[model samples]
Target: MYSLATGFRIPVLQYGLSPTESLLTKINGGALAAAIAAAALSPPPAAWPFGVVGAGAALLNAAPGPRSIARWGAVGYRRLREHTAPASMTAARGETVTWELYPDHGTMQNPAKRASFHAAVDQALRFVSDQARTAGIQVHVTHHAITGDYTTHTQTVSVHIPKGLVASPARVLETLEDEFAGLGALMRVEPEPIPTVTEQGSGWVALDDDRYASTARITGWPPRDDGTLIRKFLLGDERPPRDAARDVVPERSMAVLYRPLTQRRSRWLTRIQEAANGAFTTDPIEKEKIAIESDGRHDAMVAGEVLVDVDAYITVWGHNPDSVSAARWTMTRLADRHRIRLDWLAGQQHRAHVMTSAHAVSTRKGSVL
Candidate 1:
């Protein structure tokens, strides 16, 4: 587990080993232990070869190496067979409300306007957190931005409320629509149909013939500061000189999913973390850092701020594989400059692509890879 500067601890990767990988790891460990025991009980020249083999296997299976090979091979074989007949995905249930926000001109440029806009967003998210806590259900709020032709851009917010979670999901959506309108922005509710993914590749998925998209999750974010890090990452440097032609912008869609934790759960976790901080660390500097984070968390909790878990994924689209690869490279370079880390969805491209849509939140229990 890694703790962010915000004092939230999230797993490095929300996934664990597949069954095949676990089986192989167990077999290798057993063989190594048996060989070592035999050599200790009776020293023999013949036992040395078995020990060597076992040791080699163990070494190969060490951190981030051959241990994942079995899983990779299995996924690769399955994908190979899928090439003959591409796999498709459709929504299991629920509807989504997607609305575009058209803010006043220069809203982001003026500091006062930007602050007001941000405050409205924060209030809206807090309402969502409250609803999730009261209903005991997960609510997904996805902020999606798209640059289709690289000349014009659209920013839309999608809210998904699973069926049976509340008395009326439509009422919840209507409330959100009113919230955005209070931001002094034009809110155009766009009803989107359930998207159907037609084909999937190793790292890319096809929504149709013209759009081949590759999705990557943001794994690491720069330290918390005045929010400049995200601004620079999502929106590039200020506009180019009037005389200079603008750089080529790749067609892409970025979606960020925010899920707020319940008040009770957040408080419980914060208390546990506060107790565990200095108890486990001895270094003075490390202790100080943890102390600061603990104080921050406590202050926020006292101030009626809700803690949220955030997941961001970007999908770059193109007409062909080569074009998609090029856009992906550009996206990687941009993330690197901002000190953000991205994990491109390799074997689970189809699932990752579905997450980018405005469909229902995944109810599947277990690790979310």
Candidate 2:
């Protein structure tokens, strides 16, 4: 986790393994345990083969490259099985309310205007979060940006209230709609259902038809600086001269999910974290860094700013795999330039693809990948 001056932590997103990998890990552990038991019950020679087999499997699974290969293989096998029976298609569950935010075209082109618009959006989200907390519920706010030509973008913010969490979901939507409209941006509610993903591959998924997309999760952030990290990341360098032979501008979408912590909870957690750091830290340089971070958190809390857990996903789209892969490479290069790290959803691209939409609820709780 990285601390930002804006009182947000980068990469608060939890890491989880795919089901196949997870099952393999458990089996490996059990095999190792059985090997130990066999050795204890018998002599060395009798258990030598068991131990060797268990150790070899464990090592193969533990290594990064091999593990990734195994995961990809597992997904490929599953895809083949699915292809035999096309009716067993999977779909995301639950309903979501999405509000599209259309800011003036100049808001994205002008740096100052973009910054100001972002601040307003943040304030509006914070207000809605506070209200949701009072109502004893958690609301997922997902900001989505979709562009076809890389010139025109459609941005939307979606709110998802978990079922049975509140008495009246419609009332919550009303409050959110009102607060977001105050930003002076054109807002509209989308009535269409979430798009169904038709096909899945190693690193990409086909949405509905003709649209192939690859999704990646932001894993690491650049060093602390002014809170313009996201701005610089989204508004990359100017487009290069277009060449038909080299340029493939694939349709793309970026989604940022925000889940805010209540003021009381944020303060309590920060205090505990500070105490743990101060008590355990020994290196002088690292201790100084922690102290500075603690102070920044303190100041931000005092200023009445809410601390939020944020996770972001980007999806690059095309009509074919090759073009999508090309666009994904471009995105990877841009991320590297900003000192950001991305984990392309190798085996779970379908799920990550759904996450790039406003209708999909944020993964606040653990779910199968």
Candidate 3:
């Protein structure tokens, strides 16, 4: 018997009924049905940032197509499956899986494998949202996919801050780092200490805007405008210095010191200075053209504008592959003839280089966009 109000569809108990269904059976039914109904009526939350615009650093690197967003989700999800599947029901969060089946299925080796990984990310977000919703926390998550081994090399990140529950990159990252009891890959959460934006007054919505949906610039870590969280929400001294993430970054790893438009040049300059002590020449380019192919559902030029202030980035995605790089190179050379910067670098290339997963990868940096 199912109560329309409760959605609790209690299948009439099997076996011989005791003197026909009594008041006990009628009073309680479909408890789970009701909760599922409520969730169905609620809007879907943002799973991750809407997209990574290749804004600054993301622009300078990440190409030849590394992993897709779905691929990244696969990585995180695979680890979750392995860690939680074998645990007891009490230890498992909200998952209904028979934890033992994880290993039995031989799915551990390919955690980031497309099919299973995407499903895992979906389930993880659902569980997190359900738990938080019951506790009065609302979340927004968006998913994006990119190119790669379509397996182990993908990154799930966002600059967009979810409304209601304002958590910083550090906090969210802490949960990520400690998640699965650190059984997964070692993840580093680097929050650049710069004035960033949030959707505080904007409130949550079914669909997000272009600018705010690009990347996660601000988070709840440093605290709201009133200057809290440093001592109270977070324990430490007042007036913590910027570059806190810089200090904590893993030694000799390629990372983008992410920030808004104004800070890219400065950060790039610094990176150039530091890299000078080693190999890789960081020279100033003049009037160069760059070609960007983002797996983003929508290709916005906001990042191009940011780069245009210092260099030119042509949004060349659909052109024939054979001539695309050559065309960009020709443009850079022409610009150089007029004494303009000739360095044409594709941002995606750098991202691919940094995120190289157990492989020595070649890049297309010198190919002129």
Model 1 agreement with the true structure over 219-287: per-residue lDDT tens digits? 778775464555555556665677123323357666665556566766776776666665667899988
Q: Which consecutive 10 residues in model 2 have the weakest lDDT in total? A: 6-15
Return the clash pairs for model 1, or none.
none
RMSD list, candidates in order: 7.5, 7.2, 28.1
Instruction: Give the Å error, residue 59, model 1.
Output: 17
**Which sections of candidate 2 miss by over 4 Å?**
1-95, 132-150, 164-171, 225-232, 239-248, 362-364
Candidate closest to the true structure, highest TM-score: 1
- Candidate 1: misplaced stretches above 4 Å? 1-95, 132-150, 168-170, 184-202, 239-247, 360-368
Q: After superposition, how far is residue 150 of candidate 1 from its true place, in Å?
A: 6.5
What are the per-residue Cα lDDT tens digits for candidate 3 across 1-369?
A: 000111111223211112212332333334334444555687572322222212222222222233223233433454344321121211212211101011113233343443354344333333333322222121211111222233122222222222333344335424433332223333333322222222211111011221111111111121122322211211112334683322221111111111122224423433443333233323334112111122120132232221111111211111233333333343333333333332222222222211211111111111111
TM-score of 3: 0.19
- Cα lDDT of all candidates, in order? 0.59, 0.60, 0.24
Better structure of 2 and 3 per TM-score:
2
Which of candidates 1 and 3 is the stronger one according to TM-score? 1
lDDT comparing candidate 1 with the true structure: 0.59
Q: List, residue by residue over 1-369, the lDDT tens digit for candidate 2.
A: 222221112122112343444565567667667877877887664756676765645443433542334454655565555432122122323335666776666565677876776677666556645654432233433443444455555667777665665567788778777766755564666635445667766678777757888888776777664556665555544455673324334466777666666677667767777777777678999999989878888888887776665667777888887878888887887788778878785556755666666644434422212
**What is the Cα root-mean-square deviation between model 2 and the actual structure?**
7.2
How many pairs in model 1 have backbone atoms within 3 A of each other, for residues 3 or more apart or on separate chains, i.e. clashes?
0
